[model samples]
Structure formats: structure tokens, C-alpha cells
Target: MKYFYYLLFALLLCGCQETKKEKISRLVNEWENKEILFPKNSFFTIFAKDTIAFDTVDCDYKVFTYIDSTGCTSCKLQLLKWKGVIAKFDSLTHNNTAFLFYFHPKSAKEIAYILKRDNFNYPVCIDDADSINKLNQFSDEMMFQTFLLDKENKVLAIGNPVHNPKIEKLYLKLAMGESYTDKPILSQTKISVDKEMINLGTFDWQKKQQVAFTIRNEGDQLLVINGVTTSCGCVSTEYNHEPVQKGKNLKIQVSYKADHAEHFDKTITIYCNVPSSPVKLRIKGDARK
Candidate 1:
């Protein structure tokens, strides 16, 4: 009917009106300074192999992360990445910050295997009953699930710094007792990419495929690329770390290695000193024999 179509149009328009910046602002406002509750009766383990007692240490800050069993366990946990982050923090703060990880897994065996495979030696709470998530009712978005907490477990910021460079800077600044600013102070510029979406068509699932994207600086100022982050471990990106001068082009090489035979859609985010700093590109296709 005409009325039904009009209703759908309004809904789509409203959805399009909400920008990523606005959404992040709203989420941060809702969670900032909120206290997080941790259930007492939870199982703890080290490297997912040895039984351990959960001990609370008095630290200046705590980075708490909760992973629920829904998607690929290895991908969601990203234990290897966590290992690096933990090392970095320890070097800087010297036990001033604690990393608390809780995972509610569908299969305890899979979780254990992933932990060991990644060689993650940190203590983790394997909540098979999902008690932590139930008690906290954490947000469904992955970005909002991780929290940078104060000594009392009050949220200082909500985001995974490992996945986002901007959030990492913010977390480090706040944790170190330094003044913080959410906005970047550098001059803003613009970028132009050859393509935002790359369709690989169909390829052998077991083999790796590579694609390159050309990004050119369209602004007068130098464009500094902070980092490039992927949605999954199966995908990786390579780019020059040096700043790209105006009117120059930079090549980004993205590689995808499928672990299973299925349709896949992965995201690659580029962080730069530009107005739209975090530009996202997609690679999607079917993997077959």
C-alpha cells in the first residue's frame, strides 16, 4: 500500500541520518563512568590449560573484556593479539594495569584449544554458564564490549584499543593520568581510493588470495596513516607507515586466506590523519573447491 511504502521510506531515512560519529558519542555517553559488576563464583584458568584461582590485584587501571560464544571462537578471542597488548602494557605501566578477560564459550574444549594454540599465558575466566555477561548485560557490539576501567571498575572508556588506534591512544592517555582529548588535533585532509569494495568472485578456499588498493591523498596537507586493522585474523593488510604527501598515492595490499568453504565478507579499516580518518573497505566473495 502507499502508506506502507511511506513508512519504510521514513525508516530508511532515519537510519541513514545517524552518522558513525553520533553513534559512538551516544554509546560512550551511555557507558562512561558506569560501574561494572563481576560475579564471584567463576572458573579461572591460565593459558586455558591449568586450573587457577582468580585473584584481584589493586592496580591503577584494569582493561576488562568479555567474549560470548556466538561467532568463531578463535576470531572473537584473538588471543595472539591480546598477548602483544598485554606485553605492551606491562612494559609501560609495570603492573599498574591489569588485563581481565572473560569468555563464555559454547564448547570449553574449543576455547581451551584456541587459548593454547595462540599461546596466551594470561589468566582468563572461562564462564561456560555466561554468568559475567548475564550479570553485566553487555552491549552486543564488539567495539563497546571491552572497557577501560578505573581502580574501582568504573568505565573510563569503552572500546578495544587493539582493534582501534585512536581508542588505544585515548586509553593510554587516560590510564597514565594524563589529560585526554577524543578528537584529533592534527590537520584534517581527504583521501580517494580506487575502490571501496572488492569482489573476489570465487576462489579455492584453501589457498590465499591477494588484492591491492590504491589510495591517493586529495588534500594539501600530508596524510599520516596511523594504522590498518582487519576484522579477522584470516585477513591481513600491508601498507607504508610513512606519511603520504599531498597528490601522492599509496598502495595497500590486502590478503585473505579462508579457513572454511563458505561465503565471506571481511572489513579492512584504515586509520589516517584525515577528516574521515577511519576509512573502511570490504572484500566479499564465495569460497569453493
Candidate 2:
């Protein structure tokens, strides 16, 4: 009778251990795969121990915490200073604007605590445990991946973080309304233009007309206009000088010769620093005899 009781007790203990292990495994799995969304239409910032800092239009800074494990001890969490811009992108929260951050056990613990403490009210993501473990093995190195998506979750910009300095500049560019590409850093500067769009009314195709466009350097730094080009040979442009200084204006005289004129439309692209992307000017009119 005593032997039967002992066997039953052993079975119960074994079953309890198995159940406990399974429960722990499930929790860990969920933590690894958890996906939390930021507060919709809300703005928040993210800071890191490394480079990168984000501020909203109001210029509010973000705070973060870090965790480190010592030997066989539990993790320890410490608050970090505000570093870079990891803010919410109001209407720009499409997949293209979303950024992913991979963290290790220590970093993950700190991140998890932040997520829970903040009620998961921001646009940040925590990596899975498998990725965390891999990062742990490669502690001396850092890696990151950024994806830019359109409204339908289509990726527009895909950048792999390797070097620190290069990534820092890339983040700044994205923050300032530029899309990421595999191309090198072409230019960075400031410029002043009368308007983003130009409208030239109707003109006789048999006559020639000249219009003046001004380019200024409103920024604190020097502005460089490398060159200008038009779609057709009928149009020509001349600049004031090579490099335009701050607070100075360069006159771009555009002369259009009304030869073989019908409904005329042309686009001119000015490659410069103020607007790092591209500047387009339009000229349109009806050619009358």
C-alpha cells in the first residue's frame, strides 16, 4: 500500500515539472514574438546610448533606460540620456517610416520594462529572443535594419546599419523628409527660392521672352549650385557666379525662343544643396501667330 502511494506522488511531481517548463517556454515565445503598436496619431521620440536624437516640432526630448547583466546575476537597469530622434511620423506612419531595433537579453529586458511602463504608447519594437541571443554572441558588433513602406505596406527604403557615423547621417536625412537609397551622400546645404512652382502665362510663339528666377542662400552655410539643365535646346540659363554665399541671390535668366511653337511646356531641374532632393520649374504657354 505504501509503495503505491509513493509511485502516485512521484508521477504527480513529474507532471507538475513538465507543466511548469511548458508554461515558461510559452511565455518566452510570446515575449520574443510580441508586436506592439505606437499610440496612433501621437508623437514620441527615441534616444540611444549611441548617436541619433529625435525631437518633435515642439522640441521635446525622449528618455531611455539600459540594462546590463553581471556574471550570473540578474539584469540591472539604468536610465539613459536622450540621444536621437525616434519620434512618431503623424501621417507618415506607413511601413516605409517604420524602423526596427534588435536588442539582446540585457537590452531586451530594459526595452520590455520601458514598453510596459509606458503602456506601449509609442512607435518602437522589441526583437525576439532568438535574435537577442545571436546579438549576445556578437556583442562587440552592432547591427540594424530600416524599412520604408508606402501606404499599402510596400517597402520604399531598405537600409542595413553597419557603420555608426554613416547610419547617423542617414537617420538625420530620413527625419528631414528624404527617402533612403543605395546612392552615396551627394550634397547637403541650404538654398532660397522664390517659390517651389513658377507659372508663365500665355505668350506668342513667334516672339522671344525672358524670365528671371532668383536663388538665394538663406541658411547659415554656403550654397552651391553645380549646374542647370532643360529638356529642350530652345531654352538657355545663366547663373550669377560659381558659389553663392549666405544672404546673397543668384539670378537665373531663362530665355525661351518661340520657334516651332505649339502648346509649349518645359521642365528645368536645378541641382543644389538647400533642397537635397531636386527642384523643378515649369514654363507653359500657347504659341500664337
Candidate 3:
């Protein structure tokens, strides 16, 4: 009986382990400076103005993410927004930013049809089967998955490329070899919040409830936000990593998903050096089935 109990406990622990997708999701706004595996592949075609091979391109600041169009319409729309966001950056930006789209089609004809129909004016890779399978390992439907990786391939940010303009600026700062600091070391401090509660309105059962508010430091001291944690695992929060100077601002985006159609009312506690200390942020909304 003792041995059986121990085995059962081990099995329970194994079942509770977070999957790869969850691990990746947690990397949002973290600059771990880790390298991601870029497999060599021969099944890719580019429709951009310049005929560049996938393997030859650099990965200094690659947008390493997948866009599985086989999902819902909103996801497809977000993908389109990403494409537009990438297009805004000129060739000069391309030197550092590589929009790595991962696609795995079962048939060559399907691939041809997609390419011919979409006429995507950017680089696309026919990701290896192993990579495709690894992504599919995630149980949830992949929607507008985007990971902003630094030169070392560490995660810098996640979500749509244009989701946050400041993120793009932060990427430029890193690419230019400048450390991100909101204000001078000596003169940095105050806590200013634009809103305490943000109404997300309504989200479809398939959609995640997301909203953001501006956080500013209104005093002459450096405000260091150590972390922003939600009430539960289904709620994911992201914010800037750099110091918040007296004059500068940072946006905190909060998103949550549920297993059923119901009302969501959650709070995210923000831990920072400011006098506000731990600000209790709230989010309320209705998610329809």
C-alpha cells in the first residue's frame, strides 16, 4: 500500500507539470537571452521583392512565432495585422528584424495554393516536421503567437508585433546595444496610474479577454516594478522590464482565459519600489460561449 501511494503521488506530480506552451507563455517580457533552435530546411519559398533564402537570413531579432491560419477568424485577422506591422518596417529594419513565420503543410499543392492566394510579401519558412509537431503539442488553439527574440534568441516579448509600439522601440534600443533605463540612476521615482480598473467589455468563448492601462512614475525617483502577478494561472500579465522614470510611462497588458462561458473578475497585484507599493489592479468582463 505504501509503494502504491508513492507511485500515485509521482503520477499526480507528473500530470501537474506545465507543458512547453505554458513555459513559453511565461517568458513574456523576460529577456533571458537564450538561443532558440533554428533547424535547417529545404521546403520554403519567399514571395518578397528580394529572393532571400530562409537559411541565409540572420536571427538577431527574429519574430519567432507561428500563425496557424486553420484556426478562427480573429486569429487570422491578427495575423494580417502582424503582416502589416512587419511591412511598415523598411529594409533597414530588416537587417535586425526577421519575421520568421512557421508553416507546415501536408501537401505541396496546399503550400502552392496558400502562397499563390496570399502572396505574402515577406519571408516564410516551411518549418521542419519536428518543430511543427512540437507546436501542435500545445493543447489550445494557436492564435497570433508572436515571440520577439533578441540577438541571443531569448524572448523579449510575446503577442502581435504591433501590439505595443514601445516594444518595437525597446527592440531598437537593444539592437543598438543600449541598455534600457527609464531615467538616470540617481534621478528616478513616483507612482502614477491612469486607471485602476479596465473594462474589457465582451470576449467570445474562443477569445481571450485583454486590456491595458498606462503606468507612469510621477516623481523624481526610479520606479522598479519587480513583478505583476494575476490571481490565477489562466490570467497572464505583461509589462515593461526597464525602470520607470519620473516622466516616462509603461503599459501593463492583462489577459485571461476560462474553461467555460462566464463572468471574469480578477485582480493583479503590482509590486514596485513606488510608494503605491502593491497596487491592486482589477479586471471585469463577460466571456460568451
Clash counts for the predictions, in order: 0, 10, 6
**TM-score, structure 3 vs. true:** 0.42
Sort the candidates on lDDT, descending order: 1, 3, 2
Winner on lDDT between 2 and 3 is 3
Tens-digit lDDT string for candidate 1 (193-215): 99999999998999898999999
Give one digit per residue, the lDDT tens place, for model 2 in 163-201: 122333343445445654433344466776776545566
* Pairs in steric clash, model 3: 188-221, 188-222, 189-219, 189-220, 189-221, 189-222
Candidate with top lDDT is 1
Give, for candidate 1, the lowest lDDT window spanning 10 residues. Answer: 6-15
* TM-scores for candidates 1 onward, in order: 0.86, 0.35, 0.42
Candidate 1 global CA lDDT score: 0.77
Q: Candidate 1 or 3, higher TM-score?
A: 1
lDDT, residue 25, candidate 3: 42
